[model samples]
Target chain A: MHDIGVRETIRFLGLTFNIETLKMTWLAMGIVILIACLATRNLKVVPQGWQNFVEMIILWLHDQIDAMMGRRGRMLAPFIVGLFMFLLASNLIGLVPLMASPTNDLNTTLGLALLVVVMVHCLGLYFKGGHYIAHFFQPTPVFVVINMIEEIAKPITLAFRLFGNILAGEILIIVLLKLMPIWMPIPSVCWLAFSIFISCVQAVIFTMLSMAYLANAVKEDHAE
Target chain B: MIVLIEINATILAQILNFLILVVLLRAVAYKPVARLLQQRSDKIKGDLDKAEADRKAAEQTLEQYKVQLADAHKKAQDIVDKANVTARQEHDAAVAETRKEIERMKATAQAEIENERNRAFDEMKSQIVSLSLAAAGKVVMKNIDTKENDKLVNDFISKLDKNMFADLR
Candidate 1:
């Protein structure tokens, strides 16, 4: 597990980059794109194979998001669906030999969580105008500090929740590899199975939480 | 752990990566798949609606046939009833006409019998009067003439016909 905390980084246009994480992200993106293209290739009224499978995922996300946000949620369906697909891909990619999850890195998860938080704020403002801002100081002005901290904690928790789980799973696998060297196969398999389940669960959790936040932002508040 | 969670420019690149991914995936994946699902949902809904409409149409046609069948049944009954009424009227008229013809024939036969009986009575009276006149003439040839005898016979025959007709009445 010596290389657990070590990173493969590079310089491109004078900016430092995490090459390992970026490359994994690109791979996940490519997989997402390829799956989408293959599913959409035939474009039949009666769907079969990949078309049916992909449509099921897309529509499931559509329904889940639409339920949270109503018709307005339809606009966010593509992003939410794409995010889920990407996260699922990123999470599962770590299972491959010589591969790591992009989500296992802090940068990728933090970036995603920040994006969700920022989107929530932007959508809140767009939908509720001044009320979105005023809601922070709700019930009394004294609550603003708590509310602000809560808002800040949202992205942090979101990022760490995903990053922590995936990184721990990867670390444990490495530890098992280091500790159990020859007879590591059984522990590896067991952990791999657990990690796969955890991967799916984490992806769902992140997507659902993001959807809730977005819905909370865009939905109209009832006037008393 | 600090190194593992360190912040870097890679976050910016990753953000850019996710954004590009979202855009590209939306363009290539979500939109087309969503549209296909929508189309399939629409097709299913349309087929269901068409089936419902067809069922309703079939029910409507069945109702119409039922009404038409009822009308035909009523019409056939009316024809039978009308035929019965016409047949009764024709039968009654035929009976009345037959009764009238029978009555007329009886009256004609009575008249003809009365005429023949009157003529026979007149002839008998004439023969009786002639015989009596002859006897009287025989007696009177010694005493009267033939002209008196014929007049006597004719007057007697007329009287006999009038007497016989009165008695019969």
Candidate 2:
């Protein structure tokens, strides 16, 4: 359980890097890129096989984004879609023998959450300008402190939600394997299947929340 | 104790990796597929429009041909009717001319017959007068009475009827 919190570090050019999470992240990214390339290499007006599958997934994601953010949400589709894909891949890779899930790491999840938060704020500022900062002072001046704290807690909540779910699933599977080593295959398989479902749900939730945040930030205040 | 909460280079590295993945995937996959879909939709719309235009043009051409054919049929009928009327008029005129010529020949023949009959009647009358005169002379010469013979001749000539000689002339 302590190993879940500790990352194996590698020193290169006097900079400390988390070797395990970086390796797994790169591996997941490479898999996604390779599949994407193969699917798009011989693209036709009519799709087939993997291309058909990938296009369906992309269309589904686009619809989800559209539902969340209206027509303007299309601009954020590739980023949101990429985030979902990467997280889903990272989460599912943990089911493989001896492979650690990158999302199980607090640093990785926090980094992704911070990225989404930064993008939301930047987009809000770009779209709403000074009116974006004025939203925090709404209803009364006394509620401004509460609104600021709530805003600050958003990214922390987003990060921990994914990290806790994935890390807990991984730790439970490990404890199950340790306790029942002889008859562990059946329970481990069931747990793995359940974990896979959880991974998918967590990925979807993360993407949905990110889209919702972006929509809220960039949306024009209709109250006026 | 606070080491777990510390922000480090690993977080920065993950951010970089995520950004790189997003950029790469967007470039390689999403944009091209979306563009292809849009292009296919446009092409389909264009093809449909062209098909509709072609259909309308064909319909217009068919209508024009029908109108021209109807006009030609009417003109041909008119020409046939006019020829029929002209032929009928010419036939009637020829028949009228033939009837007039036959009437004129009949009138001329009647007049010639009348003239011949009149000449024949005059010759017969002269012959009768000569015969009567000869007989009178013989009688007169035999009996020796000239006044009585002349009176007898005058009475015979006056007693002849003009209507009785009409059939003979």
Candidate 3:
């Protein structure tokens, strides 16, 4: 129980690696890859079994991206779908005994958020050129600072929202298991069930926010 | 909170992980799946078009057969009519030939009857001339000249039998 709060930190080439988070991240990646392989193997024109299941999830994600940015977001589908699978697996993995969620680590969540934000700006620059950067100065120079703050807050909120929820839920579970003796299994079980629900909700919220941010970058009309 | 948000190499590693995953997954899954779906849709479109063409060809062939059937019926009817006309002509020609033969037979029989009656009348005249001559010679032996009596009897026979033979004719 004491070891639950501690991460296995490793030093390699003068850089500290959070090995525990890395291990869980790799496990999540393996799950994602396994699912991808299963879905794509022996693929029939008429889908069945795992192919049917994976197609349903993928088609839903595609519809979301398509609805958000229509045809322009077509290229972004792979990255978006991959991100969702990773997030979903990372967030839910903590529920298994002796395992922890990779998303509970701030580094992992921040890394994902930064990746999305950077890609959004890159896509904006690629599609719209100078207007992408010029949007921050719209409605007069007075609004530049506000727009800049809004831009900075986007990734911060995106990262912290997911990290905080997952970490807090895991921390509570740990707390309930270790200290709470008044009402033992009831609260712990309830919180665990609730945390599972929270994990799913948080993953979906992250994915949706990322899509929305990306859509804004490639939008038809610049509303800034 | 300060310790938790520390910038470290882990963030870089995680980004690398994501990038590698994307590349691998794209190769294994996305491109192939999209292509397969496109292939199936294209195949369906081609099949449907071929089916429509086949249906149209079958219909055209059926229409041609129907037309051919109708023509055959018309041709058969024409053959029957021509045969009937030829049969009627043959029947009429045969009847005309039979009537001509009958007329010729009747004409020949009547000519033969006329020739036989003339021959019988010639024989009777000869017999009657001989008998009258003999009878007159016996009756008037020394009373008249022989040469004069013969002339008188011949004149009498000619006068008496003249209309009788005419009536018989």
Q: Which ten-residue region of model 2 chain A has the weakest summed lDDT?
A: A1-10
TM-score of predicted chain B versus true chain B for each candidate: 0.54, 0.52, 0.58
Query: Candidate 2 vs candidate 3: which has greater DockQ?
Result: 3
**Candidate 1 residue-wise lDDT, B88-161, digit = tens:** 99999999999999999999999999898888778767866776677665656664656876666567667766
**Taking the tens digit of each residue's C-alpha lDDT, what string does model 1 give over A51-142?**
87887787788778767897888988888988999999999998887999999999999999999999999999998888998999998999
Candidate 3 lDDT by residue in tens digits, A1-224? 32645666888999998887899999999998988998898888888888777777777887898899878987888888888888889989987867888898888999999999999999999988998888878878889999989889999999999999998988888888888887668989999999989998998999999999999887677453
When 1 and 2 are scored with lDDT, the better candidate is 1
Per-candidate alpha-carbon RMSD to the true structure? 7.2, 7.0, 6.3
TM-score of each: 0.74, 0.72, 0.75
* Best-matching candidate per DockQ: 1
lDDT of 3: 0.86
Q: After superposition, how far is residue A129 of candidate 1 from its true place, in Å?
A: 1.1
User: Which tens-of-lDDT digit does each residue in B20-139 have in candidate 3?
Assistant: 888877777777677777788898999999999999999999999999999999999999999999999999999999999999999999999999899888887887878797769774
Root mean square deviation (Cα) for candidate 3: 6.3
Q: Give the TM-score of candidate 3.
A: 0.75
Cα deviation at B35, candidate 2, in Å, is 1.9
> Candidate 3 — which residues are off by over 4 angstroms?
A1-4, A176-193, A219-224, B1-7, B59-70, B87-169
- Sort the candidates on DockQ, descending order: 1, 3, 2
Q: What is the lDDT of residue B50 in candidate 1?
A: 100
Ranking by TM-score: 3, 1, 2
